[model samples]
Target: MPSTTAISVRNVSKKFRLFASPKERLMEALHPFRKQYHREFWALRDVSFEVGRGETVGILGRNGSGKSTLLQIICSVMRATQGEAHVNGRISALLELGAGFNPEFTGRDNVILNGAIMGFSRKEMLRKLSEIEAFADIGEFFDQPVKTYSSGMFVRVAFAAAIHVDPDILVVDEALAVGDARFQRKCLLQIEKIRTSGAAVIFVSHSLETITSLCSRAIILENGIILADGEPKIVAEQYLAILFSESKGEPNLDITNERVVGSSANQGIQINQLRDEQFCDVDPSAWAGSLSERFGYNRHEVRTTNGCAMILDYLVAGNGCDDISGVWSGNAIAILVKVHFSADVNQPIIGFELKTDKGVTIAGSNTFLAKTQLQPAARGDTKIYRIEFNTPLNEGDYFVDLGVAEYDGSPGGYVLDVRRSMMHLMIRRKQEKPFFNGIVDIGFRFTEVDC
Candidate 1:
């Protein structure tokens, strides 16, 4: 049976009148003939989606992509110009900073006031007050006016109050990103608890990892319309690909033209052909004439000094042996790295590292780590190395840094060629399985012990 729908939005659109000045606003309102003094701006257009009970849905988009406007409409903080949103149960929302709290009021007072707004009586709020305080962990700031609180503190108190009220639907709008790492982890745990308790969650964030780790489904918004909606990983990848294209001053890749490469007879040869196409596209000599010319330096971020070998190209291929723009968690994928030798070298090593946008290394591997030996390469020779495995990663944008070096018979080695931000990888959760909490999805097994 299909899950019960807890939130439904139908053909929802919002339009605001942009007045040049206060006089224009007043004139427009007073004009009996309804003379237009303001231009109309549509924040949302024909957007529709449903969130089932116990489901977590992520909204991904660029800034001003109508994400916040859609959230405000769903929370009823703002009304839609057309269409309707039907919410089945009480909602607790942490929208913009200081959204439900008065800046002049003490945090304690705001908690009680917000609780009352959520339909809890004063006594009932008092019963939950200590739990809220403990969760917020603001210490003496709890007694201070909200105006004195930091952005992080504001999020803490707001999140603590919203979650403590026992809402059937939770709407969070990039608020958790304000908190510190430890607190963010705590909030994620609480969100998981809420999901377990059957409360639907609507999360909006620029952080793809957070979205893919928490939400089972995701939607991508562009120009006030639903661009894509389905698996969190795919939607996130579409958003990133748009970003990548725009960064290079090119039009977004037409994902509609792409199809999943299916497994068939002669899959290996078909995959090899696809890989060849990928490699040819990234060839340095072809950079001036290839399709990559339109996307100048889309994959070129090289860093090397006194280098003897250089990475000529690389490819990220999906299960069907086709180059993929994005990949999903637990899906089989492959990375092919091709290197060109400029000088003879002994004990040459090739490796790759996956890093977050913040430059934190999540995982990496080198040929030395794998204890693999390869025949020495001479000048004018090229070799290809491939690694294939199932990716156990959370959804987010990641960078692949490729490097080639010669082992110096110790832990330290001489770097030959290294490229930072050489390739962009997007990983999204494909299943509605429980959210994984970390960067990697290490499938851990447990065994019972009896004494």
Candidate 2:
């Protein structure tokens, strides 16, 4: 019978001893009866989670948050100082670049070596060697020593080897970030295949978008403890809130129950009001031009700073209409932003970005980039900014992120308030156009030359 759980981590904790000096280490080894010369540092404190068959769980945290340490423990590369972790199936982990390969050994030899470590016989390794080589796509480097390989080449081989072995649990620790965009997409597809095969995956990445798109669930780790676990969207928001708080030297906000608010701004706009009210009238051309457009609102905002400035609300609507659910490709749309200033600011800048559902930014513009200058603003002032442009996106779901910052005679100066995933926009196929090839559909003239 097959195991129901792919991974089980129970109250796992890892502790490392910190020695003051080299002499302290020797002193402690020489005299066991004396007081210990080292202090204990806990990297993980009772971190507990489980992954079942066919489930993918994303691990997210800032640096020094024990994400890597936890992955190492799960892969059995390091043992926990307390508690226990059990793996029900064979594991293939890509924890670090060139972690398992011997520098002196050729890629071919390393492949066989890794397979042996995974309990495959020599014949079985040879049978799968061709498939691994083709997947890696490293031409002559397969026969050369791994030490001679670049970082990208090294990861290509390591990733190919790990996935080809058909492990029950896959643990990828930010390894895909090193690969090029094309390779990353290929790897994501392969991960999807593995998931389809009923294998559990534990993915650790700093890209919240990746976590949100790929994993059914996500957990946020902070200072070696599990801070939040549930939907990827909620967890990512909590993580961002904590990051913003830390950057501003404020107390960490509980994002679950409370909204992040500025210190001075009380009796501000309510969430429902922001959603229901029309900040501005839509352009006439936007609604009059397209009859196939639909529009709805799904917005989320996080105040990164105190009450210096606030983005009250924003809207993406078709021409001449305040309400929109979706828009056709190549149609005209307008973005309106309402901002309130509580403190005097010099050279305020506002911007917007349109990103694909996969979190890849396709196009965006800001005031600084456009060389637009605005007058300085004082407290209790409100301003409305509008940007109208034709949509260049293909048929797909996209997100709108808005930000407000103050220019300090520098590029991308101090950010005041930023909102991510503020609204979801869907782009549909236009009747006159063919299928677009990439994230954007740039209508260009075409010509062909006969050879």
Best by TM-score: 1
lDDT of each residue in 5-100, candidate 2, tens digit only: 999889999999999899999999899688799999898999988889999999988888899999999888999999899999999999988798
**Model 1 lDDT tens row, 34-149:** 99999999989999989999999999887888999999999999999999998999899999987979999999999999999999999999999999999999999999999999
Q: Top model by lDDT, which number?
A: 1
Question: Against the unseen true structure, what C-alpha lDDT does each candidate score?
Answer: 0.78, 0.76
TM-score, per-candidate, Cα-based: 0.69, 0.64
Off by over 4 Å in 2: 31-33, 247-451
TM-score of 1: 0.69
Of candidate 1, the 10-residue stretch with the lowest lDDT total is: 265-274
TM-score of candidate 2 against the unseen true structure: 0.64
Quote the lDDT for 164 in model 1. 96
